[model samples]
Target chain A: MEDLDKELVRRARLGDKDAFAAIYEHNLPRIYRFIYFKTANRATAEEITQEVFLAALRAIPRYHDEGFLVSSWLYEIARNKVIDFYRSKKSDISIDEELEERPELTSTDFVKTMETKIEADKLKNLLKKLPEDYQNIILLRFVEDLSNEEVAHSLGKSLGAVRVLQHRALKALRKLVE
Target chain B: MTKERIHNLFDKAKEIKPSEGFLSRTRARLYEEPLDHPRSQFFFESLHFGATQAGIYATAACAAAFIIYMSSSISVNEKQSVAMKRTEQIEDYKIDVTLKDARYYKEVAPNVFVVVSK
Candidate 1:
């Protein structure tokens, strides 16, 4: 899978639109979920996810292979885009606060939507109270099942730092849970 | 909640995804948009290449000028030395002729030799 992604990245770097599209398709869900957790808004997540892919497409030529998955790179972009999103909004409202303020929707598709929403809300409320780095480590390491190296790359930290952060984050989350 | 419960919650959260319509729409829009090639990168690369080439040419020019200056200066010095040697030889010839004339006059005509010496 890493080889395939590397091949796709190599081709995409050469302006292969199809290769880029493939990369977009493969990474879209993870990036979307990442943004979704950050923003806690479906529309905003979708918007940021689109922006992340566009940014990635433009910057594909500059991306060098550093023995990490492309998803790690996408995660980094998604993380920055989320930061930019919050900065532009200039709202001090946190994700948990945003989740609380979110209106309950009623629809014929309520069952599935509510199930997904409740799960996202529960996860967010639990993870959101932690420090930003802790939340990122938890989400990327556990929720996204990214390797420690990939998490390290995504968070711009050393593997040892990621391990420490993961341990601390889990301990913090455990306290919150208890 | 144990770590197991937290993991379970995260697993459920993974079910959250963008709608199919949103996915398709985004893909279409991304494809419609042209990929951006940062002009700044191109400008810098061109500047760097131009500077390197200019440096190579300047070095070559300086080496050629040094070679030409050294060769020309050596030839000029050789010409000056040859001219100085020729002048010295002419002076020696004049001295030899005066000595010979002085000797002949001293032997053949002492009075004429006095005038000649004067």
Candidate 2:
């Protein structure tokens, strides 16, 4: 994975459009999922995901051959983009807006939607109720299936610190779910 | 929440996928953006590119001229100091000696000879 990322980034640095697009495609799901959990709004998540990739696109030239994975760098950008989104909104006003102003559902469609997506929807709302750090740890660890070391790399924390955070985050998440 | 519930939640969450058309739309946006090129490339392509490059060259020329001016001033100061030291040496010479039919008077000041060679 590291070698593949290095090759992709090397091509990307040299202005390979296809290479960059490949990077975008490779990281899109994880970044989108992260943002989706944070914002709990598909539109906002999609928009922020776009912003993250564009920002990454613009920054690819300045990327050095530091031994970090490209995914790690992408995650860092996603994290900052989420922060900027919140900072600009001043609160979760958009989340509330999305919940409040969603188009009314027909009865037949409502039942279908609930049956299919209820657990995911509940998970999103419960994840949002936790503190930001706990939410991130839980999502990255369990949902993304990143190891503790990978989580530490993305979060810039020590491995032991990540473990402690993961434990606390799971505890907090349990409380929220109950 | 129990550990089992937590696991179940994560399992459901992991099933969440991005909406359709995301890849195509994003790819279009990427193609539309000129982000693949370096900023300086655009800086050179824009109308202001020439003007900015010319400005940079002109500033470099001015800097070169300033350095030359400083060095030339320093050289002039060096010459003046050397001349002053010559005068000081002349002030130190007070002895006059005549040897082998050549008379020597040490010069103490300009146009005042302490040593005269004949």
Candidate 3:
């Protein structure tokens, strides 16, 4: 994996379009899957995924060979992008608080919408029950499929620390699920 | 019934693949962005890479300058203290004027008072 990344990076440094394409192909699944879990909806995930790739394209050049595992580097970048998205989104909600103006619903298709809304609310509440750090860890580990080592590298933590956090995070989620 | 449901939820979440057209749309966006060659490639890299190097250099230079500055000040202090001690020693001498005045008076008034040399 490291070798392939190095190869792509080398080609990419030389401004090889196909190499960049190869990187995109290799990474899109991981990026998309990670984002999908953060946002439980499909459309938002897709938009964030697009933004991730665009960001990657813009950032590929300054990547140094400071023993950075490329996948971890990419994962870190994606993590930051996701955080930025959520921050912007949260701030936007605070701006107008426009959603509060809606009256009691009388529209058709309301039952299905209400069901999804309830489930979403329940899921969000369960997510909130975990510490923010644990939530981030679980999202990266189980949902993003990044290895503990990768997560540690991305988060700039010791392997033991990441492992401990992952353990605690899984336990916390188990409480929520059960 | 168990925590497996959440674990399974995560698993199911992973299995929920993106739509098939995802890549094509991605490719379109990719192409729309300059592939591996854009003005920003230079702007971002030069700005970031240059700034990192500059920061490290600046920190090291400042440290060196501080050391040099401190050592020079210490030596100056040492020299100043030595000069201060010398000034103190020179200033400690208090000359008495009585003996010299008396000698002059005797020499001028020899007719009135004889001064014997002892």
Per-residue CA lDDT of candidate 1, range B1-118, in tens? 4978887888888887677777888889988977654457546655776799999999999999999999999999999898667556544554333666667645543434132333
RMSD per candidate (Å) reads 13.9, 11.9, 17.0
As a TM-score, model 1 comes out at: 0.66
Task: Please write out the lDDT profile of model 2 over residues A1-178, one tens digit for every residue.
Answer: 8899998997787677899999988888888888888885777888889999898888987987668778878888899999898888744444333323334556785565455357777888887778888888988889998878778888888999889988998888777767
- Residue A68 of model 2 has an lDDT of 76
Full-model lDDT, candidate 3: 0.67
For each candidate in the order shown, give its overall lDDT on alpha carbons: 0.80, 0.76, 0.67
**Can you give the lDDT of residue A106 in candidate 1?**
45
- The alpha-carbon lDDT assigned to residue B118 of candidate 2 equals 48
Alpha carbon lDDT at A44, candidate 1: 74
Pick the DockQ winner.
1
* lDDT by residue for model 3 (B1-118), tens: 5666676666555544455577777887787776555566646755776799999999999999999999999999999898666445434532233666546544543333323343
TM-score of each: 0.66, 0.65, 0.58
- The best candidate by TM-score is 1
Q: What 10-residue stretch in candidate 3 chain A is worst by lDDT?
A: A92-101
Question: Which window of 10 residues has the lowest lDDT sum in candidate 1 chain B?
Answer: B109-118
Off by over 4 Å in 1: A90-109, B37-118
Native contact recovery (fnat) for each candidate is 0.65, 0.60, 0.45
Error of 2 at A158 (Å): 1.8
